[model samples]
Target: MARQQFDLIVFDWDGTLMDSTAHITRSIQAACRDLSVPVPTDEAASYVIGLGLRDALAIAAPSLDPHDYPRLAERYRHHFLLTGVETVLFEGVRELLEELRDRGYLLAVATGKSRVGLNRALDEVQLTRFFDGTRCADETFSKPHPAMLQELTRELGQDLGRTLMIGDTTHDLQMAINAGAAGVAVAYGAHPVDALTALAPRFVAENVPALRHWLREYA
Candidate 1:
């Protein structure tokens, strides 16, 4: 296909690129436990994977006082940063990114992770060079908000209509819609397949290879 559409391809971190859903879910639960707050079920915890940390904690632990959000957030980070609970990129993720970059597609990240978190992960994986620009929740509006996409497009000199957002959650799709851009969903990530489908993304890939195939033929 000769790259017929989309000049910029934006991705979400955590569940989308990294196999960190379980780690994140566990961390959130552990944070709640540490605070002696009601712990969210596995599903409940995982559903907030693509949202900013505070927003996700609020939804996962609605009973917690707002003043304690920082404490919960700190506990969550502490749990996540522990050695055994670490996360890694999905199989073929690095290769897919390399291929896309070589194909001359402008790659970027619009993730719920804070700038420090995303930077650390990218540098640790040595994948930081693949992205031309990146946006984190702490520096701007979080997922499902158009500000990140809007700013990325403007900074990269790309058109919104020619931008593509790829992620594993509905928040990612809604952000694409709000930004007037197209979206592609991956079923292997955080949100359920059904939730992502309801947004009517351009395509829903089942896994990393399938996603690679889609991009090779259509992206």
Candidate 2:
């Protein structure tokens, strides 16, 4: 079978291009511990990979009252900022972005993270220059909802059929499906290959090298 191709590549921020789960987990766990709430395990944290902090907290700490979410969220942000200290682009991610950008592939990020959070990480890593722009969950936009991608497509003037969305979660896959773009799931981050395969993404890669190979052919 022939490999699929695309002209624009959209990425999910946290687990796809950045190794942020450790910071994410640490922040969430610290906040929960402070509130006397049970801390979620690493595996459980993966379930919230493509969700905003507020939504992730709701899912991870469901037993807590909704009224307490704001306080917890504030604490999580504080801890994350102070300790979200460790972050680096996954090996070969920077090269892959450079290759894609040089090849005339329009690059953008559509993440469930908030604008502030995404921008902070991007700035820290000096990667904000790589993307044309980003669509964040803080703008009342979340993955699995086509609005962000749709808005991005319109803003970038790219054809939806030639656009591709890549990430490590079902939320990212569903966003592609909903927005009429191709979906590529990566297995090396938070989710296992079998789990990502279940979603039937157009392509799936196990690591940054594999992803770059596939994107070179597909993009």
lDDT of 2: 0.84
TM-score of each: 0.98, 0.93
* lDDT for residue 70 in candidate 1, whole number 0-100: 100
Task: Compose the digit string of candidate 1's lDDT tens values, residues 1-219.
Answer: 378888999999888899999999999999999999999999999999888888999999999999999999999999999975555899999999999998999999999999999999998889889999999989999889999999999999999999999999999999999999999999998889999999999999999999999989887
> What RMSD does each model have against the real structure?
0.9, 2.3
Model 2 lDDT-worst window of ten: 1-10
TM-score quality measure for candidate 1: 0.98
After superposition, candidate 1 runs with Cα above 4 Å error? none
